[model samples]
Target: MTDRTPGEPTGLDIALQWAELPPEHLKAALQALEPELARRHEMRMLQARLEAQGAEDRRSHLLYLSGLVGGFLIVVAMLTASVIVGINGLPWLSAMLAGPSVLSLAGLFVLRRVDSGTARQVARAHDAALGAAQPTPGAGVV
Candidate 1:
């Protein structure tokens, strides 16, 4: 751990020192700081919201891409099985098609589930942040 002075400057103290204002200016300084601080807080919240939204979008896109690729591979496998059956026999055709079909279905199911769960989580986080940022009725009003 690092050592700190007993009277180390807090954020307000640092701001006051930087501004070279006297103690009598405390109230005015705080009044000025309020809106600036509120704006900074709002910016941070917006950034968080954007990040969450971006993550959800990426997950959705990934799920869609995976499904598309899986479907393509399954179709290719079916065509290959048909060709092999026509050339040699049906003995190995079922074995060749079964694996790809089962894997494609399972992958699609998993991707859908994961995407929905991530979406719900992001939505809940956004709602919670929005609710917290808004004041309750009659609050902070004289």
Candidate 2:
């Protein structure tokens, strides 16, 4: 290996630096970056999405608890909407049947009211759910 200092370029390395590269060179550069960038971007997006999905029960993330409470309200709303729509027909009836959309939507709103840390917890919980899940039949177990 060639010993070099910082900010000092060797002849071969200097030749590789594309100060005057054509537009086509950009394609190669992008091609080299494509997979790595895609992976990095995907990971970042997943991180944000996870953060948005944290739990409300965490101590510092009590705001997420609002969503949990509102979830109960949403269920109530859907049941109420369904019962009302059962007497009616058309879109209203459809609304009753589809009221869970409202319930889940409300859940999302409640989730949104939470802090970023809690949202991250939600994502972690969700990810954990997707892993080798087993019944943890205890008072406080994963």
TM-scores, one per candidate: 0.49, 0.29
lDDT measured at residue 68 in model 2 versus the true structure, 0 to 100:
72
lDDT top scorer: 1
Q: Rate the local accuracy (lDDT) of all candidates.
A: 0.62, 0.58
Write out the backbone clash pairs for model 1: none
The number of clashing residue pairs in model 1 is: 0
Those runs of model 1 whose alpha carbons end farther than 4 Å from true positions after fitting are 1-14, 17-24, 89-142
Clashing pairs in 2: 51-119, 51-120, 53-122, 53-123, 54-118, 54-119, 54-121, 54-122, 55-122, 56-64
Candidate 1 local lDDT, residue 27: 60
**Candidate 1 local Cα displacement, residue 117, angstroms:** 24
